[model samples]
Target: MRQNLSVEEALEAILEGARPIAELEPLPLAQAYGRTLGAELSARVSHPAADDTAVDGYACREADTRGASPENPVRLRVVGLAPAGQPFSQEVGPGQAVQVFTGAPIPLGADAVVRVEDTRREGEFVWLLRPASPADIRRRGEDLVEGQTYLHKGDLLTPARVGLAAAMGHPVLPVVRRPRVGLLTTGDEVVEPGEPLPYGGVYNANSYTVAGLVEEAGGEPVFLGKAPDSPEELRTHLAQTQGLDLLVTTGGVSMGERDVVRKLLEAEGQIHFWRVRIQPGGPLLWATWNGLPLLGLPGNPVSAMVSFLLFGRPLLFRLLGRSDPPYQQLRAVAETRFEANPARRAYRRGILRWAGGYRVASTGSQSSVVLRSMAVGNALVVVEAGKPVRAGEEVEVIPLPGGKTAG
Candidate 1:
């Protein structure tokens, strides 16, 4: 095997070259928070039916308030008060106005609004400071026109976007259901968590961690327990499980002698090695078997995690028909002095952030076996392959795998 491939070459081997919607059922919007979209969603209605008061003020005709100044203001009697969720009783005529609160529907024949701060109240009479025009009012359908599309098809259902759909009066939405992800971990030296560990056996962290990551990436994870080192048992266990959108296997993907998953699924799909030029996740294997994504991950906990983030995460979004899930790669200004070796690009785990207009990252270590570093890190510091990046150099950093955004 070659040492490492460029990021593009690695990605090419992993991806199927075309994106298609995965097999999934339609789920109600209430239970579809993290689910990927299956199809496009259309707007139900326009934003507002009429001109609305964005602020709490009085609505009146601007022409009626002409000649009104700070010194000698025009006084108009407040005829009615309109609050949100209710209609205004009377329209503003000459020398008359309606007191409206925020989000209240503007009364008919009202042109402009005068804030309460610029007015003096004397019983039912309020004074205006300056001349107001009808042009000062928000026009009809200003926020959104009727039947306009706020969100198009194949869009992810982010919380804000969901709220936007709700604002458009859509109670239920048509979104793609989350695909079921079957997780399997293989290693004779792995033990279940909360169990007494025998010598040379460690607690199984990849299964749970990967399951959590799957759920976070909008996929339903099905734990297939643990598979032993035998190839027959692994093949039988995996072959029996059906209707899965993806099957993820960790701890048996590397070239180690105990690695058996690659050979077990050899006939089902063509295996391709991806030397994803990133440290801790350099070795990657991908294929499609029986209309399902088969991703064989590295044995090291850190390596498995990085592979899932860089490749598996985006694949889930694409399968669910989310054109661009919330995976933003932002460049934080350099704040600390750090160096990298000339090899694979390193995805340094640390608390990456911007403070005083500089990027700061501090990870405990870059070892592929450390889970403590991943626990405390919020982002990845990207170092280019085959080169060293000095402090203050701008490097692309992908955000920690959370949220519904895209990369």
Candidate 2:
């Protein structure tokens, strides 16, 4: 097995450096988020059925209202009114106007909307000052043509993207189902949560934490909980992942006597690599059991998280068939002088926010045991192994919770 690798090398191994996640079941549109998009969604009946109002304004015939200036002004009869969510098919005669709200369909025979602001209303007739131009009109299907394609296949269904699909008339969205992940955590010193922790022992947060991250990354997290260091226990855990799309384990990956996770996996599965040249997350591991993907992350909080992000997260996303197989990476500037001289990639827990036009990040302490930093941090500042970075320098970052956070 390979050892002492860069974070990218570990990620490449996790991506299998080759074979992709097998196909998954078809999913519904409503439950698409936290799942991947396997197929592209096409337009059913096009969009914006016809020329409609883009703003709340008066719909008037262009010919009748054209050149109706502020000085001379043209008077037009108000024949009818139309509100949003409703459309009127009645044709507008010359010198006639229709009170229109935003999104209201422009009546037939009317080519322009002289905004209500530009027109003075009367009981039956309205006085228009500004000249209505072709620009004022939202041409029929101007937003989308008939049978035009709106959403492409293989796009992640974010709230905004999902909304777009909904607008495009996807009733039952055809999406790839969330890939199921079997989460296994191993450590002799680690105890199951909700129980007593003896001296030098703590609860198992990696299981729940990484599971949550898996879900946010668009996969179903199957909580396998903590597995003992025994080969039988490890075998049972690995066996339980029979139908799962992926299996991710925390701890028991280092080359220690008690680090039996890899050994147990090796009994049946093939070990591809072990160890990485990264701070806080060096003892990373990867394997394949019966053709199912397996990941062995460092047990420390920060290491596990970094391993999950750089390795497991993207693999899970692709397996689920996310519209975008690989997630989008963002760039941010270092908010303060951050120090690291480790021989491996350093993922510093930190917070990032927008200042002026730049997104800057501050490095929180890089301690693997620090949970408070993870709680407060919005982004993970990525520093290459042995790379020294100063304040105002640029670095890569991944959001902590995987969505927009409220300041």
TM, every model: 0.87, 0.88
lDDT of 2 by residue, 1-407 (tens): 77777767777667655333456565456766544455666666545677778777788778787678789889999888899777776989887888899778888888888878887877898999887655765666665554667666566677777777677777666666667789888877888878898998878889888988887787788888778778888777677777787888888887788888877766767888888887777888788788876788888887898778777777866565454545455787777866675666677777777765446455466688887677777777777767877887888877665645334
In order, the Cα lDDT scores of the candidates are 0.74, 0.74
Candidate 2 off by > 4 Å: 17-29, 66-71, 82-90, 323-331, 357-364, 401-407
- Candidate 2, run of 10 with poorest lDDT: 18-27
| Model 1 agreement with the true structure over 1-407: per-residue lDDT tens digits | 33356766766555656365555565555665655555455556655667777777789888778889999999888889998878696667787899888778889878788877778888999889877545445666676666777776567677777777677776766666677799988888889988999999989999988999898877889999888998877877788559887889887766666678766556555666634567877767776656667887887998898889888887777666776853677877554544564777777775675565436465767788998877877777777766555667766677687522211
TM-score of 2: 0.88
